[model samples]
Target: MNDSLPGYAERLDALHQALAADFRAIIARLPWREHESILDPGCGDGFFTGLLAERLPRGVAVGLDTSTAFLEAAEARLAEQIEAGRVRLVEGNVDRLPFDDATIDGVFSAHSMQSYPDLPHALREFRRVLRAGSTLAILETDNVHSIMLSWPPDLELAVRQAEHREIGDEDSYIGTYFPRFAPRLLAEAGFTDLQREYIFIERQPPVGEALERYVELYLKYLAEQTSGRLDAAATARLAEIGDPRSKRFLPRQANFFFGSLQTLITARA
Candidate 1:
């Protein structure tokens, strides 16, 4: 996927507002002190990493991700902060983090865990890097299945069809239902003091440029799923269905799974 599209950065920035707010809420409840270190696994664009740096006093914040494109964007977005020696952006995968055991005080990841092929391996890595009693905060979207159900009947059917055509392989694109089983996974990873909280945000209807960008991305993903099987005529029909002019009849709803599940995990050496 092209991460450098013109409006992509802006759209991601808007989305990060909600993400950063949730992270702030999570941090507010935790007992943090000066000079502690935190890792943002899958820190796309480093928006939350910057937020963490601002909130922590004399602390080190690192943003890690597998995508070099995203890491570069993050570095650029956080250049001023980086030059000030507040944040670090590293290119790495979550399953194999580049950090010493017991080196970090906390791990925060959002919206990316669902794409991992081996979630348990990633969770183990998070467990291995944090000191004993360190906290981990994960925020991700629920299944596309759940999302489809929340839409209007006509729109839901359209989205479901698009998704069905898009899943080329079940093992390859195992979307975001991982959080539903997070409690069990945390226990398996030797984490204690587990808690889960669900956060729901009212959907703000996209307008003008935002709506245009949203529809374009949605159709782009849909096209990828169909893999050119959806010819021009079919594509045009889907576009008509997703038209913002009809948004009043088929409103878009955004539902995210924000888990404030905190657990004390053992660090490996």
Candidate 2:
């Protein structure tokens, strides 16, 4: 197992549990074919892959991920589907797919494109493997679009700016450029009929435990990432609010609210 697999899976599971309804709704919105094969590249743990398989009762969901550990976890999660022959998890890289050209009927990727070693090369590979007129759907979000807590807007803005200044070009922050570049990149890669949608999820006080836990983890991540980038007072404030045991924990505040926006872009090959 990868050294970070436990933490990575926990964070993904918490987020999935918290926003499960929205995630299902988004996947349900896609146009599915009952007898066509769909490729889910970068399908870690098969969370979204299982949903894709559910939509295609008679079709197959081919999940391709680079990590053997992640594929093992995905296999365990989708054991029933795998036995039914509706889902298949493979160890492979997105940019250099193992399949022949133009063999896939459709492709669905989520929150993983930003991590591709080469964005342009991966986009071409997606186009190459997809049949003519097949759809490619990608769901991604920027740090600015992905989070909104009930804290002060000024502090949030400061943290956002700090993140951009520090690691904006890193894979973790690369999603920030997707909204602006995805269309052109897809077009350049020989895809057509591009479209985009913004999905919003929000919750108020009395939110679920999953959401609360996700928020706590996200806060801690933000605090860790911007530890020395922000001013001393701002850094201290983030630490206090991020700590669940602290009196200033924001999740415990009255009228606490949480919201996020994810961008979904679909293109035809």
Instruction: Output the TM-score of candidate 1.
Output: 0.73
What's the distance in Å from true for residue 105, model 1?
Answer: 0.2
Q: Give the per-residue lDDT of model 1 (tens digit) for 21-130.
A: 55566555545565778888878788778877776768878999777777888888889778878788887887689998988888877666666788778888988998
| Model 2 Cα lDDT, one tens digit per residue, 88-150 | 988899768989999999999898866776887899999999998899999888656678889
Query: Clashing pairs in model 2?
Result: none
Check candidate 1 and list the clashing pairs: 166-225
Among all candidates shown, the one with the greatest TM-score: 2
How many collisions between residues are there in candidate 1?
1
- Residue 30 deviation, candidate 1, in Å? 4.9
Q: How many clashes does the backbone of model 2 have?
A: 0
